[model samples]
Structures are given as structure tokens and as C-alpha cells.
Target: MEEIKLNEVEPYVWEINKEGDMLVPGRVYGDKDIIQHLLDDVKQGKEWNALKQIKNVACLPGIQKASLAMSDVHPGYGFCIGGVGAFDVNEGVISVAGVGFDVNCGVRTMSTPFTKDEILKVQEQLADSLYNTVPAGVGSTGDIRLDKDEIDEVLLRGAKFSMERGYGTKGDLDFIEENGFISGADPEAVSDVAKRRQFKQIGTLGAGNHYLEVQYVDKVYDEAAAKAYGLSEGQVLVSIHCGSRALGHQIGTDYLKTLEAASKKYNIPIRERELVCAPFSSEEGQKYFSAVNAGINCAFANRQAIAHLARKAFTSVLGGSGDDIKTFYEIGHNNAKLEKHDVNGELKKLIVHRKGSTRAFGPGRDEVPEQYRAVGQPVLVGGTMGTHSFILHGTEKGMRDTFGSAIHGAGRAMSRKGALSCCRGNDVLRELRDKGILVRGHSIKGIAEEAPKAYKPVEEVVDVMHNTGIAKKVVSVLPLISIKG
Candidate 1:
């Protein structure tokens, strides 16, 4: 690992000074405990870690401000898991590691016009309904079967296509980020193999860290913001966490070779294989970026279809119309979006790459939905199956410092191999059941892989974000039932 020195710029903030081949400094947001963990990893001789990745990203062409990481910083493919980097459109490069293989992998939490008490009445039945209704596990296939031509439509239209196909409602668009469709997506940019992978996988919940959890608001931190989001104590909600399924992964795989070749062609020095990228204005760069947007759209469509399936399952067991469950807010953590931001005194367009980091736009941003403009965009911070999740609001400080990014979840404390080595899958299931929580997983080993002990304490993680004014807490939710893939 590279020896990186951190100088405290402020409480909960650290900076790595510009050094050899570095174009910008590296900035990390974390408290003492988090920083110590990173230091510990370095001391243990881990070659690939967040600090090193942060430094590597700073060396990339056209990187702006700083190579940033939120509180949940952890070693990832090229960028740190909670990494955020904004680049000049003309001079910047697009890295597959920044967008991640999952593409728009995110969380969509829908608030139901019901309470925990109501959910408890049919808890077991509801769990069964969800586990059976939604497809899960590796290579999970959904009921939807789209032809090649229609697959292109899903790439272009996103959730709107799902709605037109009788999944979800039109009202869902406003609550979704980018109105559920990202512009500049070219279906033709995506390969036939990627499209074929999505033929029957549109609505499936694929394995690994993806799940649908039924949660209830346990506490409210901001009354005004909670009210605006239609959340109150004991309110039941469903949060779907997944991404572009197979299509996203296929795109990432297909583009890796192209970008690697482009990296050499354009003379862009590569610090890591996953960091191979082309200048954003270059031919190969445009193709990969366009394909990535298509993957984002594919993810939006997947979540929309799954959310509607969730509605049906909820109504079947709990007795209500689909309208009873409304899309509270849908946002992705893995994305590369082109937007205008303040660069010094001038407004400049930059492509912001956020991996395992949510877009947390603060109040007064025109991009935020009108209803949430005064408060800020809702940031859904997911927790573990046995722990708590959070709904936070973007902060002005966050936008100014972090390119409007925040942690996605309690950063993983243990790898799946580590978790499986010590924990038993059935034991994990039994423990959750003993805690009065219901869990349905297609693979028991997957359950053990996500054992609660495998993650950092989410409460501790959120406190850092709130204390730093990166993102403020609005509500805390506890899971009643979870469906893991």
C-alpha cells in the first residue's frame, strides 16, 4: 500500500496533499474510529485500501475538487466504495469502477399507508407472499419476457416503460431520481448480449447484498422532513435494494476491454486495471458512458417492476389497493451523471461519479422535486437485516464538500468468505427469527454471508454523517421482515 499521510483539515475531515503525479488532493470524511480502521488496514499491509484508491483516483485526468469518500469508505474495485469524483467533461475520464458493475444499484423505499401494528397481523403471510411473488437468487428470472426490440425500449424509457407495461403507477415517476429515466441513454450503445441477459431478468432480485425488506419507522429526527416524506412513527414501508441485474454486469464486462485499449490509445496512465478509462469526450468514452446510462435505466425499470410486485404482495396479505403504497423516494448510489455545478465562481458541467454513495442534493437545488425542494432530497440509507435503516436529507455542506454524496450503508466489516467461515447460515436465520424478525432467503449461505455481525454499526455510521452536516437524519426504520437473494 502507498504510504499516505492524512492532515486534519477539520473535525471529521482529512486531506492527503497533492504529491507525485497527483492532479488534486484526496479528501476523506470520517470520524476518529473510521479513520483508525483505515489506518489499521494500512498497518496490516493491505495493498489495496481506501486511502490508496483515493490517492490513485486523484491522479486521473481532469479530476476536480478532490477524490472524495463519504463516511462508509472501504476498499473497492478502483475507487473506494463510498467514493465520489467530479470531472471536467472535456478533460475528465470515465472509469468502470466509479459506476460499478451494478450500475444504478440503489434503494427505493415506498411508504405504505399502514402501521407496524397492521403488518404484525399478517407478518408471516406477508413474508411468504413477498418471497414467493418476487424472483430471487443467482440467475433469477422474472415473469416479464421482453423481446430484443422491447429490451431496447426498457433501456431508453426506463421505469416509464415498466409503467406502460402495467407495473407501478405514473405517479411513481416524480418520486424517482431523474423522473425514472436518465437522458442521453442510447439503446444502440448497449450490446445484444447485455440485452439478451435482461430478457427474463428485468424484475428479478439477484443475489448478493440485494434484498426487499419490510421496515417500520422506529424514530424521527426531523419532524418537518418526516412529515414532508409522509413518514411517522410505526409507519410500515418496503425498501427494494437491487440494480440493473445481469444487464449492468454485462455492460461493465463488455466495456472493460474497450476502455483498457482506449486507456493505452489516449495515453491515460492507469493506476489500476479497474480504473481504465478514456477521456469523456473520446469515442470509446462516449460509448461506455452511453451504455452506463442504459444500465441505469435498466436498473430503474427493474426496481419499478419489483416495487409493483411488492405492492401486489402487500395488498394480497394486508388487504389494500396498490395505491395504498406510494413511492416515497427512489435514488441510486452507483451512477455517473452529467450536471452543472459551481466551479470556483463559474458554473461548469462535470460528470460526477458516485460509487456506493448516494446523491444527496441539498435544499434549493432545482434538480430536487418541487415538493422536497425546501427540505432537501430524501436519502435512503439502508442498514442490515437485523439492524436499522435511515431516511436522511441532503445538506448544503454535503453538496459543497462531497459533490452531494453520502454513505450508502453501514460499510461492510467482514468479507463474505470471512462471514461464512465463522457464521452458519441456518444459525443466522434462527437468530433473526428469535429476534421477532422474519427472513426469507433463497440461499441460506447467502443469509450467513450477510449476517448482522458482518457490518459496521449503522447507528454509529449515521451519527458521523449527521454530525458533519453531510446528511441529516430524518427517520430511522427497523426491519420486520426481509427477503434476501
Candidate 2:
């Protein structure tokens, strides 16, 4: 590992000046405390070497502007989690590592007409019901087992596949990012092995940081924005957080070898083999992109199925037909999308790769649903278990500064192994129960690994985004019931 140094560029902005084959500067966003933590990690010779990873991303081909890290950034495969980078579509490259193994892994919030009081009274039963209805953990299979042809349809149609099957409403599509169906998803691009791995895993919440929680809006920061998002203080909401399951992992595994070979063929210099990629216009790049896009749809459909199951669970526990649970919005944090953005005051097509980062398109953009166009895109920020999550909206400052992006979560402060060493799963469960929060999990090991102390304080991360004007906070949600895989 190489030593990386940072210089304060501005408030909440730190820069790693271009050096040693770097194509652009690397920038990270965070308050003094968070920034110091990153520096401290580097000093301690820790593996979450975010600064070095950021510098590595800056060295990639055709990278535009800079390699950007959001407030929640922590080192990941190639680009750090919360990493953001865009490149010229014709000249740039696409890496499966950039989009991450869990493609389109994201968060979706569904607000209900019920209040906190209504939910807490049955929190125990609700937790059990959710756990029973939704499949979770490693190798957990869901009720909806798709055949080969139906799986192909799911790969092509995404949430619409579930919607037509009576899983969700047609109106729910508009509230999802890319209308819950990203285009250019070709089933043929995905390998049969990847397809086989995905056959029985449609709605499962595969383990390691994936979960579904029931929460309530405990604080309203921006009244107008909260109103626009159909949120109010004391309102109950359920957040589904998972992704493409085995489908994405298999796609990444299958393409990494191809990209590594393509990198050599294209004569693209590699500072880190983890960042393997080919020119976006190259055949290898197009194939992987199409395959990854299909994986994104698979994730959308997976979440849709989970959402349907959640509705059923809520109906069984709380009374109403689940119609009262309204989709606030669904957005992916891991993805690469082709879009047109202003470059040097001129519109240019670019492929924006955001790994562990959420798209935060601002007001007036057609990408934002018409109902929310005035406020901007809703950004869902999930917190650690027993912590408070947040609802934020996009801002123009974020669009100009970070290609319309924001951090996805309170990034890991400790690895799962490290967390397990210090925390006991049974103890964590007891503590959360003491805090008036109910939790259910497949195993104690899973619970210990996701201990609340294993993450940076989410409030601090959310504050940095809010203060920096990347995303404006609307409300804070306190967990009542948590179901982890």
C-alpha cells in the first residue's frame, strides 16, 4: 500500500492533489471529525484505505472533473463505497467493480397512514410477521420460484413483471428510480450460471448489511419537503433494503475475468486490477453493461416482491389491506447510467458510475417524478440497526458539485469480524429491545456483525450532506422493528 496525503481544499472538502499517473484530483466530503477518522485510518495502516482508493479511481481512463467521495465514503473493492465518478461515454471505461457486486442494491421507503402509537403496540408481532413472510439470510429462498422463461421475463421486464403478477400497483412504478425498469437489459447478456443462481432467490434479503425495518418519523426538519414526500412526524414507514442477490454476484464474477483481459487488449494501464475495465464503446464493455443493467432490474424486481410481502405482513398484523402503505420512492445506490450532463457549459453524454452512492437529481429535472419535480429526487439514507434513518431531497449544489449524487449510509466503522469480536448478538438484541426496538434475525452471528456501534453515527453523516447542500434533510425515522438477514 502507498501512503496518501490530503490537503483541505475547502470546508467539508479535502483533496488528494494529482500525482503519479493520476488523471484528476480526488475529493472527499465530510466534516472535521469524519475527515480526521479517514486520516487516522490511513495512519494506522488500516485496510479501509479510502484516500488511496480515491487516488486509484482518479487514475482511470477518461475520468471527468474529479474522483469524488461522499460523506459516508469508506474503502470498497475498487471505487470506495460512496464513490462517484463520470467519464466521457465514447472515451471512458466501465468496470463491474465500479457498480459493485450487488448491483442496484438500494433503499425504498413506504409510508403508512398509521402513526407510531399504532405500530409500537404490536411491534413484537409485527417483527415476527415480517420475519416469517420475508425470506432472509444466506441461501434463503422465496416463495416465488421462477422458471427459466419467467426468469428471462423478469430479467427483461423488472418490477413490471411483479406488477403484472399482482405484486404491486402500476402507479408504484413512477415513484421508483428509472421507473423501476432500466432499459437496455438483455437476458442473453447474462450467463446461464448466473441465471441458475438467481432462479430461487427473487425476494430474499441476502445477508451482510441487507435488512428491512419498520420505523416512524420522529422529527420533521423541513416541513414543506416532508409534506411533499407524504411524511409527517409520528408517521410509520417500512424501509426495504436489499439487492440483486446471487444474480449480481454471479454477473460480477463472470465479467471480471473478461474485463481484466479486455484491459490488456485495449492497452489501458491498470494501477489496480480490481478496477478492471474496457472502453465504454468496446464490445466487452457493452456486454458487461447490458448484463449489469439486467442485474439492476432483477434487484428492482426483488425489492418489489419484498415490498409486496411486507404489505401482506402489515395487513396480517395491523389490519388494513396494505393499500395505506404508499411508496415514497425507491432509488439505487450502486449503478452506472448513461445520461447527458453539462460539461464545461455544454451538454455531453457521459457514463456516471456511482458505487455505494445515490443519485440526487435536483429540482426541475425531468428525471424527477412530476409530483416531486418542485422538491427534487427523494434520497433514502439507511442507518445501522437501532439508529435513526433520514429522508433527504436533492439540491442543485449537489448536481453541480457531485454529478447529482449523495452518500448512501453511515459507512462501516468496523469490519464484520472486528464487530463480532467486541459485540455479542444476544446482547445486542437485548439492548435494542431495551431501547423499545424489536429485532429478528436468522442467526446471532448476523446480529452481532451489524451491531449499531459497528457504524459511524448516521446523524453525523446525514448532517454533513445537509450542511454541504448535497441533500437537504426532510425528516428523521426511528426504528421500531428491524429484520436482518
Candidate 3:
């Protein structure tokens, strides 16, 4: 890999001038230290050298303005993780690698009236109850089995299906992106294999970096925004990190092969084979879009069911009534969406691919929930198991600058294998316990790979987002008890 010179555009922005087949400049948001660390990773060749990937992403057809990378940028399959690129709908192409296999893989946060002291008292019992109630580990399944008709409902109604089944209330939908459902999802576009896999996994939390954590608001940066989010210092909350599960993975794998073959048929030239894509108006593109929408719906439902299970654990441990806890916000990352944006001077519809990036729609955006319209959409940034998480609100500057996108999380500093080699799972659990965080998981090795040291400092990432005016910090949270898949 060649070292590209990065010019400092501002205190929080860096740019790489266009070169080779690159159609636009590459922009990254981060501090000097984070930039240097990413540069070192390129030198070591242990992970995706993100800088080159960012440049490669610029080569995609019909990309508008620039190929933007967030502070958490890391090398992914084709587009770098944390990459945000928008392309003209009429002229652009949709690539499977850009959207990722885990479509709508995201985080959801719920705040409760309980206090930190109240939670710590029953932390161990709550963790064990959650671990038992929520099916996890590789290829985990749950009690809820959906038939063909029911599967179609899940793909269309998302969290609404769970609400109708008495898992959640109507008000909960108001806080989720797209009311926890993506319209225009055609279940017929989903293959039988994908449907079969999702049949029994609706309420389960699958393995590998997915978790349900019991956290407390440690500090408030913006008091008004924190209060609007129903959070106060020492207040207990639950954060669920999950994705579309097997259904989404199957769709990506199945369609990418088709798209690759179609790319050859269409005679589209590309530097990388993983960047397989079809024109937006093509039949293949429409089919993949439908499958992607279905996957997004699956993720929304997955998080809702997991939240229901978490509520059960809370009620079992705290003896809470139905109205004691409520969902604060549910948002997704790692997906693509059709959005309207100004290109040069004309407002045009574009397909925005946010891989490992979160949509940070600014104030007045119609897509934002009415309750949060004044404050902007809430952006949940989860850290590693034993570190601080942050709540941020989208800013108008983000809309004007980066297609209304922001960093998703503290990007991985090392691969899971590398992190596990450096830290033992038992030691990590002990350390977390020492810090007053009760931890429970099915596998000890899972804990080792997700150790706090394995990821970049979330504080730094939030700082960059704040400094860059993409998102502003609302509050900071710390875990009291956590359950890992």
C-alpha cells in the first residue's frame, strides 16, 4: 500500500487529494493521535488499511462531492468501515459490499426511573436472568417461530409486530427509526433459506460483539437534551446492540454473487471484485434493494424483541410495573437509504451507503421523530465492555458537510484474534468486576476479544464528532452490569 499525504482541512478534518481512479477527495474526521494510530495500522498490515479503502471508495460511480469517512473509519470488505458516500439515484450503482451483510445492525437505548444504587443491588441476579432469558451464542434460537405468513409480517411490520404480540407498547414505535419498520419491503425478494433462518431467531441475540448492557447515566453534558432523552445522572438504562441476524447475512451473500455475475454481464469496470454493483434502475439492483429493506425490518424487530427480554429481566430483578421503564431511542447503522440532498445547487435524490456509520439527521428533517425534532435525532455511541458510552444529537453542519452521517462507535483498534491473544477473558472479567461492573457471558473467549483495550477510546471519537459539529454530546454513560452473546 502506498502512503497518501493527508492534508489537514480543519482541526477535526483531514483530506486526501484525488489520485488514480479516484473521482473525488477523501475526507476523514479525527484528531492527530487517532490519525497516527490508523497510519500505524497500515504499516503493520494487521487490519484493513483504511486510508487506501477510503480512496478506493471514491472510485465508485456517481459518488457525489466526496467520499467521507468518520473518526471510527477502518478497512471493511470494500468500503472502509465508518465510510459515508452518497450517489445520484438516476446515475448511481448500489454495491452489496457498501451496504454490508449485517444490514441495519444498530444500537437501541432505553431509560428507566430506577437509580444506579437500586440496580447495583440486584446486578448479579439481573445479569444471570438476562443471560438465561435471552438466547445467545452462535446460531442461537428462541421460542417465537414464525410461519411463512408471519415471516412476511415481520419483514413488513418490524417492531409493530412485537407490539401487537404484547411485547411493547404503541408509544415505543415513536422513538424508533422509521417507526421500527421500513416501507416497501417485499418479502418475496427474500429467499427461503433466509426466511428459514429467521423463523426462530426473532427474539434471540446472536454471538460476536452483540450484547445487552445495563448502564447508568454517569454525566450530563447538555442538560436539556439529556432531560429530553429522559436521562439523569445515576439513572439506570439498558442498551442493546444487535443486527438483522442470519436473514440479512444470507441476503447479502446470495445477492453479491448475483451482482458479481451481473457486473460482468453489464461490463462495468471496477478495481476490486468485492465492489460488485448494479445500476440503480437495473432489475438486479431493485431486487437487492428489496432484500435489503426486508433485512432492515428484521433488525428493527430483533432489537425490539431483545428489549422485551431485557424488560423482563428488569421486572424480575427490580419488581417493576409495566410503566416503570421506556425505550429512549432506537437507531440503526450499517445500512443504505434513499435520501434527498443538494448536489452543487440542485436538490436530487441519492442512495447513501453508510457502512459502520450512523445517520445523523439534523433538526427539521421530516424523518426525525416529532418528539425529537427540536433536539435532532439521538446518536448512540457504544464503547467496549468496560468503557464509557456517549449520547449525541445530530447537527445541521453534518447535513451540509457529510450527508447527515456520523461515527457509529469506537472503531476496532485490533482484530478479535489479536485482542484475545493480548488479554485473557478471565482477567478481563476480573478487571471489570473490580470496577463494579458485573459481567456474564456464555463463553469466556468472547469477553477477551471485547475487552475495553481492544477498541479506540470512545471519549476521543465523541470529541472529534463534537469538534467537527457533526454531532454534539448530550450525556455519558457507564455500565453497571452487562450480558454478552
Candidate 4:
């Protein structure tokens, strides 16, 4: 690998201008140092480069404007992590690789009345309680088991389905993105294999970068936004970060095979084998879209159920009904949405794919919940177990430039295998304990794979989004306890 040349098109915007095989230009949002670090990876001969993935996405059919990479960009299958691409609804293609295996893998943060001191005092007990309550790791199953009819209902109704089982409140839906459900989800489109995988997997925090964390609002950068979001200094927050579990993986796998053949039948050329897709209007594409919508709903329901478990764990440990533990916001990263966006001075319908990216709708967007419409959509950027996470508000600039999107997490700086080789799980656990962060995981290997050093500096990643006016920082949350899978 050599230096991958990029033109600094503007402040905080780097571009790999359109060339051979690219239908659109590739753009990445980050500062000089962040951009340079990405370029240096080429110099170091890193096999995977985010910029290359962005360029590959640009080569896909019907890509509109540009292939965009958010501030927390990192290489992943097909599209880079933190990649955002909007395709023309009529002409563009829908690809499974655009939405990773873990469809709608996302995060939700809730505020608690308890202060940091209060949670810290019983952190160990709370950790044990949460670990015992929430099922985790690969093949982890939970108490919530559903019949075929019930599973279909969960696929269609999302969090509301879980709430019907006495897991959450109707009020919680108000704070969830898309009101905790996406319309047009078709259970029939979801394969029988996928449904079988999900029957007993609901409410489980399946592994690799998935966890339920207890954090405290350590800092507030925007007083007004923080207040509107119900945050205060030293306030404890619970963040449930997981997804549709094995169900999403099975759905992605099932669809990939269908789309692979559909791509050929539809005469869509493939640049990368992983980028198999069908035109949006095609029958295969419509079915995949509907199935993916169901997968997204499954994730919403999954998180809703897990939130209920966390609340119960809190109630048992702290001795209260725990109404004060209210939902801050729920948003997904791995998804593709059909939306109407202003493109080239005309509002056109598009399917925007955000793989490891978040929707950051700005102030006044009707899609934003009424309570926060005056501010903007809340974006949750999760950090590694040993780092600080952040809350940010969407910006008008993001809507104007990147189709209202921002990065979703601290992008991995190293592979899990690399982290495991260098960091011992017991040593990592000890380090977190020394810092007063209690952690419980199914295995020491899981802890080692998620060691903090596996990711980039979280502040630097968030700074690019904040500085570039994509998402404005509201507050920072530091982990006090983490229950991992």
C-alpha cells in the first residue's frame, strides 16, 4: 500500500474525486489528523482501508451525490463502518452488504434519578444482578420465548409487541426513532430459517461489541441541549447496545443468496462480489427491503425487552419501581431507510443506507419526536468498554450535506484478533476495576476482544463530527459498569 491521495475539498471534508469505475465522488468527513491517520494506514499496508470502501460504494449503481463516510469511518464488509450512501429510489440498487449482518444494531440511553455516588456504592451488586438477569454471548437465550404467531407480531409491531407483554411503556415509544417501529415490515418475507433462529433469542445481548452499560453523565457541552435531553452532571445513565441478535444475521444471510441471483437476473453489474444488489423497484429488491424492515423491527423489540430487564435489575438492586429510569433515545446504525430528501434542488425519494452510521435529522424535521423537534435528533455514539461515550444533536448542515447522518461509534482501530493477542482479558478487567468500572462478561476472551485499545480515541472521532457541523456535542457519559456478551 502507498499513500492514497485525497484532495482536501473543504474544511473537514476530504474527497477522492470521481474516476474510473466510480459513478460518484467519494467524500469523508474528518479533521486533518483524522484524515491523515486514514491515509497513513495505506502507508502501513493495512489490508482494509475505509476510503477504498467509500470509493467502491461510489461505483454501485444509482448512487446519488457522493459516497459519504462519516467522521468515525473504518473499513468493513462492502461499505465502510460509518458509511452513508443515498441511492435514487427509482434507479438505485439495494444491497444486503449495505446493511451488515447485524441489521439495526443500535444503542439506547436512559437517564436515572440516581447520582454517580449512589450507583458507585452498589456498582458491584448491580453488575451481578444485570449479568444474571440479561442473557448474553453467542447462542444466549432468554426467558422471553414466542410462538410463530407471537414472533410474527414482534416482527410487525416492534417494541410495541414487547410492551404488550408488559416489558415497557407506551411512553417509551415516543423517544424511540421511528416510534420504535418501521412500517412496511413483512413477516412473510422473513425466511422460516430466520424466524426459527429468533424464536428463543429475543432479549438476549448476543456478543461481539454488544453490552449493557451503566454510565454517568460526566460532562455537558451544550447546556440547553443537555437540559432538553434530561441530562445533568453526575447523573447515571443506562445504555443498552445490541441488536436483532441471531435473527438479523440469519435474515442477512438468507437475503444475500436471493439478492446474488437477483442481481444477475436484473442485469446489475457487480464490482465487488460482496456488493450484490437488485434495482429498488425490482421484485427481489422489494422483498429484501420488506424483510430487512422486519429485521429492523426485531432489533427494536430486542432492545425494548432488554431495557425492561435492565430496569428490573435496577429496581431489585436500588429498591424502587424505577420510573425515573426513562428512555433518552433509541437509534439504529446498521439500516437502510426509504426517505424523501432534497437532492439537487428537488425533493426525491431515496433509500439511504447507513451501515454503522446514524441518522442525524436536524431541528424542525417532523421525523424527530415532537418533544425534541425544536432541538434535533439525539445521536448515541458508543465507546469501547474502557472509554467515554457521547450524546450529540443533529445539525441542519448534516441534512444539507450528508443526507442527515453521522457516525455511530468509536470505529475499531484494530481487529478483535489483534486486540486479543496484545491484551489479556483478566488484565483488561483488572484495569477497568482499578478505574472503578465494574465489568461482567461471559468469557475472558470476550473481554479481551473488546479491550479499549482496540478502538480509536473516541474524543477525536466525535470532534470531527462536532467540528464539521454534522452533529453537535451535548454531553459525555463515562462507564461505571458494563455487562458484556
Which residue pairs does candidate 3 place in steric collision?
A: none
For model 2 the local lDDT of residue 66 reads 90
| lDDT value, candidate 2, whole model | 0.90
Off by over 4 Å in 1: none
Model 3 accuracy (lDDT, Cα): 0.87
- Model 3 ranges off by over 4 Å: 41-47
lDDT of 1 by residue, 188-209 (tens): 8889999998899999999989
User: Whose lDDT is greatest here?
Assistant: 1
Q: By TM-score, how accurate is candidate 2? A: 0.98
TM per candidate: 0.98, 0.98, 0.97, 0.97
Question: On residues 1-485, what C-alpha lDDT tens digit does candidate 4 reach at each position?
Answer: 44467898888899998988889999998878778878887778877778878888998889999999998888788788889989998899888888989999999888889999998789889999999999999878989998888899989999999988988855889899989999999999998888988999889999889999999999999999988888899999999999988889988888888989997898877656667888988999999999989999999999999999999999999988877789989999999999888899999999999999999999999999888888899999999898999999999999999999998998887788899999999999999999989899998998999999998989998998998899999999999999999
> In candidate 2, which residue ranges exceed 4 Å CA deviation?
46-48
Error of 1 at 25 (Å): 0.8
Clash count for each candidate, listed in order shown: 0, 0, 0, 0
lDDT (C-alpha, whole model) for all candidates: 0.92, 0.90, 0.87, 0.90
Shift of residue 137 alpha carbon in model 2, Å: 1.1
